[model samples]
Target chain A: MHDNAVFSHKVLPFFLLAPQLIITLVFFIWPAGQALYQSFLIEDAFGFSVEFVWFENFIYLLEDPEYWNSVRVTFVFSAMVALVGMILALLLAAMADRVVKGASAYKTLLIWPYAVAPVVAAVLWWLMFNPSMGVLPFWMDAFGYDWNHYVNSGEAMTVVVIASAWKQISYNFLFFLAGLQAIPRSLIEAAAIDGASPFKRFWQIVFPLLSPTAFFLLVVNIVYAFFETFGVIHATTLGGPGSSTKTLVYKVYEDGFVGLDLGGSAAQSVILMIIVITLTVVQFRYVEKKVQY
Target chain B: MVENRPWLTVTRHLVLILGVFIIGFPIWIALVASTNSSSEFVSGLMPLWFGEEGFGNFRRVLTNEERVLGVSVSASWMMWNSFIMAMVIAVGKIVISILSAYAIVYFRFPFRKTCFWLIFLTLMLPVEVRILPTYEVVASLGMLNSYAGLTIPLIASATATFLFRQFFMSVPSSLMEAARIDGAGPFKFFKDILLPLSVNNIAALFVILFIYGWNQYLWPLLITTDENYYTIVMVIKRLMSAGEGNIPWNIIMTTTILAMLPPVIVVLGMQKLFVKGLIEQEK
Candidate 1:
C-alpha cells in the first residue's frame, strides 16, 4: 500500500509535520513521560521533599484492597456493559435487518443516543430513577422494591452500567446491522429451503458470519466502557455508594486530582496506559485480519 | 422475505418498536421534565405528559437574563462556550491531521515514521489516564480557563491522520505524475487536486469530530475553572452537585436538552457521513 512515487521535498514536509509532532511531544509524550517518572517517586506532604521509591508505589497499589476492588469493579462493570449493550444491540439490529419497511425510521430513532454525551446520558437515567420523584421508582414502590442508588452499591453499579451501556447500544447496533446486511441473502434462503428453522439458521449461519463484527464491537465497547465513561460516573455517583462504581479510570482521577496522591495516581495511570495499549494492539490486529476478509 | 413466517415479521416490528422506545425514553423524559415548572416536582411523582411551561422554560434557558435563576452562568453562555470549543477542536484537528498526513504520504521526509509512531502513541494515553500531569503542563503554560487550554492539547489526533494517510495512499500515483507534468508543485497539486478529492472525507470526519468535541466533559472540567469558559456538557455536573434544596429539575433538564441538541441534530442530519466516519475510524 506504500506510495513509492512520492514528491522529493526537503524542508516542506517537515514544515507540514511540525504542528502535529510538536503538540504530540508537548502534550502527549511529555506528560506520559512525567507520569512514568512520577510513578517511581513519592513526594512528601508539603510538596517540598521527594524520595525515589522505585517499585514501592506499584507494590503498595497491588497490596491495597481498594485497588483490587477497583480492578474487580472495572472488569465486572465492563463485562456487564459489553454483554448487555452488545446483546440488546444484536437483537435490535437483527430485527431491523429482517424488517423492510420503516427500517430507516427505526434506525433514526435508535442511533440518536450515540450523540448524547456520557454525562448527559447519566443525567437522563439519573432523573428516571431519582428514587423520590422518579418514574421507575414510583412503579417499583408498589411492588415493595426500594430503588435508591445512593446507598446501595449494587444499584449504583447498575445505574452507571445502564447509562454507559445505553449510549453504546446505538454504536454496536450500527456495526451489527452493517454486518447483518452484508451477509448473502441466498445463504439464509438456501438454509430455509433445507427446512432449517429460522433460529437454527441464525445461530449457525448468520451468527457465525457476524462473529467478526461482533468481535470488533466487543473490543470497541469494552474500551468505551473503560475510559470514555468517566463523565458518566463522575457526574452521577462520583464513584459513590462507597466506591462501588469506581472503575480504574475514575479512581485515577479521584486519586490524582481530588486525593492529590501524585505517586500512586501516576502508577495507576501507567497501568491504565498498559491496558489501553493492549486493547489498541488487539483491535488493530483484528482490524487487519478483517481487512483481508 | 427469507421465510414466510407471518408471526416472525410481527415479532420483528414489535422488537424494533420496543428497542426504539427504550432508546428514545430518556430523551422523552428529559424533554418532558424540561417543559414543566420547578415546583411541579415537589409532588412526589414525575409527570409523564407535557406541561404548559414548555415555551417559557426553553426561552428562559436560552436567554441571557436567566442568570439569577440559580444557574450562575446562563445556558446560552455555556452553550456558546461549547460551540466554540467544539468548532475549534474539530477544525484544528482536521487541519493538523491533513497536513501531517500529506507530509507522511506525499513527500519523503526524514524521521517521518518516527513522527507517525509518536502521534500513534497518543491513542493509548487519553486525558482521563494522565489527568494530573497534563493539567499541570497546561496550567504551567498559562492556558487555564481559555479556549486554547480547552482545545489545543486534544487537537493532535492519530485516527484522523491515519484515515487521511490511508486515503492518500489509495489516490492513483498517476494523478500526481500528471500534476507534476503540468508544472504543478507539491503544494499546487495538494491544493488543486487532492483537496477537491478529499472534500467528502473531510465532511465525514467533520461530522464525527464535531460530536466528539461537543461531548467532551472531563478535559473541560479539568482546565476551565472559570465559569466563563464552562462548556454546556461540563456545566451539568456542577449544577447537579450545587446543593440539596429543590434540585431544579426543570432548569437542569432544559439545560440537558440544550446541551445535547446540536450534536443530536448533527448526527441525525448527517447520518451517512457520521456512520461512514465512525466505521472508517475502526477500519
Candidate 2:
C-alpha cells in the first residue's frame, strides 16, 4: 500500500514494533501455543505427573455430557441475547431516527449504559431481582408469580441473558443509528411521496439498505455474546443452579482452575480459540465485502 | 420533515421515552438502593426515593478499611488501582499501536507482512481463551499482584493498530514527500506532522480504550491476588458474594455507582469522538 512513499530504515521499524511484538509473543502466542500443546496431554490432579494422550482430551469432551450441555447453554444464551439486544436496539434506533428534536438527548440517555461494566450491570439487575428484598419479586408476589433466580435454572438463565443483552443494547443502538443516518433522506421522501407509509418505507427502503450494518452487527453481537458476556455470567450467575448458566468459557475456567482438569480445560481453550478464529475470519471477510459495496 | 404526520411524530417520541425508561430502570433502582439504609433494604422492596443515607453510604464505602472477601483494601484504593490500570492500558495500547501502525504503513522493513499477520493473529486469542497458560506465564514471570500484570498482557490491541494503519494509509502521500524534501527525518515527520494530524483519532481511540480498560473484569480477576492490586470492577463481584445476608447493599451500590461514573462521564463528554472511533474501528 505504501509503494509510492516509503521510509528506509532498517532498525527503526523493528524498534517501533518491538513493544507490541514482545507483548504479543509473551502473552498471546506463547500461551496459545501452550494451550494447543497441553490439550494433547492429560495431567493428574497432582502437579507431579503428566501423560501425552493425543486427541484423548477431545474424545473425552466429545463423550462428556457437561461439555455438550455447555455448548447447548452457550448457543441458547447467545441466540437469546443477540435476538433481544438487536430487536430492542433496532426499535430504539428507528425511533431516534424519526425524532426531529431531542434526538441527541435521547442518545445521551441511552448510550451511558455502554460505559457500565458487564459485572456492574449484573449487580444492578441482581439487586433488582434479588428475591429477598427485590422490587420485581415483591411486585410479582401480588400476581402469584415467583421471581427468584437462585433456585430456578430458567430464571437464572433469564437473568444472565437480560443483563448481558441490556449491556449490549447501547452498542447496537449506536451502530443502528449510524446506519440509519447514513441512508439518504431523499429515498425516504420519495417513498413517502409514492404514498408509502412509514412502515412500508422502513421495510422497503431503509431496512434493506441497512442489511450490511445489520449483518455486521449480528456477527459482532454474537461474538460479544460468546466472549464478552463472561463478566455478566461470572458476576451474576457464576454458572449456578446446577450449571444451568455455565457457558463453555465459564466451564473452561471452572475446569482449569477450580476443577483442576487442565487437559480438559486446555482442550476447551483450544476449541474456544478455534471459534474465535472462525468468527474473526468471518468478520474480516464481511468487512471486506462491505468495503466493496 | 418528509410528511406531515402528527401521529407518527408523537409515536416516535413516546417510543423513545419508553425506551429510555426501560433502559434506565435498573440504574434507578441501584441509585435508590445506594441511598437507603440497610434496614430499609431488608424491610421490603427498595425505596424509590433517595434517603438520608446517600452521603453516608458513599463515605463509608470510600473510607472503610475492613476486608470484604478478604480484600482489605478500601473502595477508594481499589478505584485508584482501576484508574491506573485503565490509564496504562489505554495509553499503552495507543502508543504501541500507533508506532506499529506507522512502521507497517511507511517503512518497507523485512518481514513486515509477517509482523502485521502476527499482530493480526492476536485478534483471535483473547485473554479468556488462553487463561491457564497465560496465567502460568505471568506467574512464572512473577508479575502477579502488580500493575504490569494487570495491564501489560491486555495492551497489545489489533483493533487499535489496524485503525491507525487505515488512517495512515488514507493520509496524503504528498505530505510525506514534502517533509522528506525538506530533509525531515522519519521520526521528525512523525512527531511534527503525523502526531498533530492523529490528534482526533488518538482522542477517539482513547475514549474507546479507556472504557474498554475500565470495564475489564476477567483479566484483572485472573492476574491480581493481592488486595492492594484489586481493581474496582474485580472487587465488585467479590463484594456481591461476600455474604448473602451480610452484604451492605447500600455501600456496594454506592461503589458500583462510583466505579461506573468515570467512563460514563468520558463517553458523555466526548460523544463525537467515541462514536467516530466505534464506527471506524468496526470498519
Candidate 3:
C-alpha cells in the first residue's frame, strides 16, 4: 500500500500490458481505425487508390434495395432465433432443474450441439435440408407432403433458423440452468404459501426474477445471429433462391470482400458497428434496468 | 427455485424430455444416415441395425468411387491446422489473460480504466468489422497461407482478457497480501497461489475458446486460399458440392460425423466442468 510498492506495481503492469497493447493496436485497434478511414471513400476490388468520396458510400449503401432486404432478414432472423432459442432453453433448463437422477447424462446429451463448430453445423444442416437426399425432406415426402425449401422463402428462412436455434438452444439451456440453480428455493415456497396460481406464480415470481439471465441470453443470441450466421449463409444458400437468406453481415462480406468494393465494405462495417454499439448501449442503459441483478 | 406445486414436476418432466428428444432427433438421424448405405440413406428408411453398408460407406467416404465424392487430403491437413491454431490460441489467450488480468486486479495503474474499457469496447465489434482490415494486415504481414496468419492474430483475445480480469478481481485480496508478506513477488504470488485456485475460470475459458476456434469459419475461409489450409468443415463443404460427382449422403454425413467427433467428445467429456465452470463465475 506504500507509494514505492504501488508505483512498482505500475511498472510490472505496464511491461505486461505493453506487448499486448501493441499487438492489439497493430491487429485490432489500427485495423478498425483504418476501416473507419476507408468508409469515407471509394475503392476498387484490389484496394488501389481509394479516392475519398465523402458520404457517397453511405449514400449508396442506404439507397440500395438489396441492403434494405438484408436489414429486414437480419432482424427477423435475430428475433426469431433469439426469442425461440430462449424459450426452448428456459423450458429445458426448468426440466433439467427438476431431474432427480441422470441429470448429467441429459445435460451431456443436450449441450453437445454447442460443441459442434458452426461450420460443421452449417454442413450438417445443409445436408439435412437437401431436397432429394436430405433426411427431413425425405420424411416429409414419405408422410405425403410436398416440401421444397428452394421455392419457399419462408421455408428457407425456417431451415437456417432451425439450424441456428438448434445450436443456441443448448447454450441458452446451460446458462438458464445455471441461473435457475442460483435462484433460492425459499422464494418459490413463499409464493406457494400466498396461494398464487401456478401460472400466475411463474409470471409474477419466476419470470420477473429470471429477466437478467434472459436478457443476457437475449443480447448474446442477437449478436450471434447478427454476425455468426455468415458461414451457414455462405455454404448452404450462397444467398441463393433469389437472395432470401442474405443478412447484414453477409451483405457486408458480399459488398466489402466479394465485390471487392473495399470502401463500401468498410462503410458497411462502420454502419454495422454503429448499429451494434447503439443496440448494446440501449440494452445496458434501459432494458438492463428491469433485470433483477 | 423449487416449486411447491407438484404440477410443475410432471409438466417440467414432459417438456424437458420432449425438448431433449426433439433436440436429439436430428443428431440421431445424422448418426443413422451415417450408418446406412447411400441407397438406404436416400430411401430414408427408419430401420436401425448394423447394416452391411457401414463398412461400404466408410470405404466410399475414404476412397473416390462412383457416386462417392472423396474426402480430400485437405481434410486431414485442415483439421491439423485448425487443431494447432485452436490449441495455441487457447493457451496463448490463457497466458496473456492471466498476466493482464492479474495486473488489472492487483495493481493500481494509471491506464487501468482505459485498458479495461478498451476490452469492453472490442467485445461489441464482432469479427465482421475487422474482417476487411484484419485481412489486409494479415496479408501484408506475408502470413497468408501460413500458420502465423491463423493463430497469431487470434492470440490478442479481448474476451479472454476481459473474462479473466473480471474473474481475478473477485479473488480475495487477502490471498495476495498473505503471499506478499511472505516476500513473494507478483509473478511468484500469481503462479504459486492465484493461478492454481482459478481452474474453473481456466476451464471455462478453454471450453469457450475451443468452441470459438472450432467454429471459426470466415477467418479460415478468408485467410487460407489454398485447399490444404481448409479445415474439416470446409473439406466437407467442398466435397458435397455437385461438381465432384454424386454427393454421397452417406459420405457427407460420415464426414460431418467425423468433423463433429472431437468437439462432441470434448463437450461430453468436460460436461461437468462446462456448467460448473460457468456457474462458478457467478460466485
Q: Pick the TM-score winner.
A: 2
Off by over 4 Å in 1: A1-4, B64-71
Candidate 1, B-chain TM: 0.96
* Residue pairs with backbone atoms closer than 3 Å in model 1 (clashes): none
Q: Native contacts retained per candidate?
A: 0.81, 0.82, 0.54
Model 2's DockQ score: 0.82
Ranking by TM-score: 2, 1, 3
TM-score for chain B of all predictions: 0.96, 0.97, 0.84
Q: Which wins on DockQ, candidate 2 or candidate 3?
A: 2
The predicted structure with the larger TM-score, 1 or 2, is 2
Looking at model 1, residue A215 earns an lDDT score of 91
In angstroms and one decimal each, the interface RMSD of every candidate reads 1.2, 1.0, 3.2
| Residue runs of model 2 more than 4 Å from their true location after superposition | B65-70
| Pairs that collide, model 3 | none
From the highest DockQ down, the ranking of the candidates is: 2, 1, 3
* Full-model lDDT, candidate 3: 0.74
Locate the minimum summed-lDDT window of 10 residues in model 3 chain A: A1-10
